[model samples]
Target: MELLEERIRRDGVVKAGGVLKVDAFLNHQMDIELFSQMAEEWKRLFAGKPINKILTIEASGIGIAAVVAHHFGVPVVFAKKTQSINLDGTMYSTRIQSFTHNRIYDVIVSTRFLGPDDHVLIIDDFLANGCALRGLLEICESAGATVEGIGIAIEKGFQPGGDELREAGYDLQSLAIVEAMDPATGAIEFRS
Candidate 1:
């Protein structure tokens, strides 16, 4: 986690409107080495849990989730933002608003992949308002699956999402929690 915090401090960009762009390394153009390291951290942190599956929203989260699934020796299931022709059957669906894209997406997952027998570990790139994760949680609920834990690469501590999830009794582990950010100064403060 310290490695991730250091990377954010060195490479993360701060923009106005409370946006922190980590696409250079975390999302857009990924650092597999960094991701592998992060997966190891999460694997250690969530040890002893019955985590049989890794769930994530499509796009940015898929890469992280895949790497994590490899470390956990579990299959990764990503919720698609749009239903495709290849997908057919009973599906668990929900609506999620993207904080970065500023749009609503109808997210879905095939029922065949997840069920009541699965013990899931939800993984995502970031957590701000918690909309995407909330949607994934809804799908898990609909499937009657047990949520073992939630692993996040970065979390905005100033935001209410992480706190709300924690208050709800979720084992949410965020590698880097940004306590505050200054757009003008390009300064980022991480929670200790």
Candidate 2:
């Protein structure tokens, strides 16, 4: 996690309205080695849990989830933002508001890939307001699956998301928790 914090300090960009863009390594043009290290950290943190599946929302979270699933030796199931023709059978759907995009998306997951037997580890690129993760949790609830834990790459500690999840009794692990950010100075402070 120190590696991730250091990377964020070096490469992360701070924008107005509390946005931290980490596209250079964390999300857009991914650093697989960094992701692998993050995955290893999560694995160590959540050790001994029966995590049979990895779940994440589509788009940014997919790449990180894939590498994490590989490390866990489990299948990764991403909740699609839009329902496609390829997705068949009963689907668990929920609405999620995107903090970055500033839009609400109807996210869904196919029933075939998730069920009561699965113990899932939810992974994502970022957590701000807890909307996306809430939607994914709803789908998991509808499917009657056990949520083993939640793994996040970056979390804006100024926001209520991460704290809310932890208060709700979730075993959430965030690699980098930004305690504060200065847009003008491009300074980021991480929680110790």
Candidate 3:
């Protein structure tokens, strides 16, 4: 977690409207070694949880989820941003508003991948407004799958997303939590 916080401090950029861009190491060009370290930390956090599958939303979440799944020894299931023609009729869908892109997407997951018996761990690259996390939770609920835990690469502590989940009694772990950011100064404050 300290390594991730340090990486964010070193490479993360602060933009207007409270946006913290971590594309250099996280969202865009990934640091696989750093990701592996984060995955190991997550494995330690959810050590005793019955994590049968790893679920995530597409685009940014796939790579981190894949790496985390490797540590869990489970298959990764990413919710599609758009329903492709090859996708079958049986699917669970939810609408999610993106804090970064400022758009809503219909996130879909195949029914075959999730079911009542599954104990899922939801993984994502960032948590801001909590909309995507809420949407993923809805999809898990639709399939009757239990969400054992939620793992995030970075969480904006200034935002209410992570706090809401923690208040709701969910086991959530974030590698780096940015408490504040100023675009003008390019200063980022990480939660200790």
Candidate 4:
């Protein structure tokens, strides 16, 4: 986790809309070595839990989820932002407000990929308002899958989402927690 926090300090950029762009390593042009380290950390955090699958929303979270699935030796199931015709049968769907994109998305997942038989570990690139996390949790509940834990790469501690999820009794682990950020000064403060 220290490695990640240090990386964020060095490479992350803060924008006017409370956005921390980590495209250089965490999300866009990725750093697999760093993701492997994060996967190890999450594995250690949820070591005893039965995690048979990794769930994440599409776009940014896929990269982290894939490496996490490798660590857990499970398949990655991403909630698609759209319903594709290739998916058959009943689907778990929920509406989520995107903090970054500033729009609502109907996220869906084929029920076949998740069910009572699965114990899922939800992974994501960032946590801000908890909307995305809540949508994923709803999908899990609809499938009757046990949510073993939640792993986040970066969490904006100023945001309500992370605290809300913790208060709701989810075992959420975030590698880097930014306590505060100032786009004007390009300054970031991390939670000690």
lDDT of 4 at 103: 81
For model 3, residues 79-187, the per-residue Cα lDDT tens digits are 8886333546788888888766768788898898999999999999999889999999999999999999999999999999999999999999988898989999999
- Candidate 1's error at 131, in angstroms? 0.3
Q: What does candidate 4 score on TM?
A: 0.95
What is the Cα-based lDDT of residue 63 in candidate 1? 97
What TM-scores do the predictions have? 0.96, 0.96, 0.95, 0.95
The true-structure Cα RMSD of candidate 4 reads 1.8
TM accuracy, model 1 = 0.96
Full-model lDDT for every candidate:
0.93, 0.93, 0.90, 0.91
Which residue pairs collide, candidate 4? none
Backbone clashes, candidate 1: 0
lDDT of 4 by residue, 1-192 (tens): 789988998999999878899999988899998999999999899999988999999998999999989888999999999633443557888888986777888899998899999999999999998899999999999999999999999999999999999999999999889999999998999988
Candidate 1 vs 4: which has more lDDT: 1
Listed per model in order, the count of residue pairs whose N, CA or C atoms clash below 3 Å is: 0, 0, 0, 0
Where does the lowest 10-residue lDDT sum fall in candidate 2?
82-91
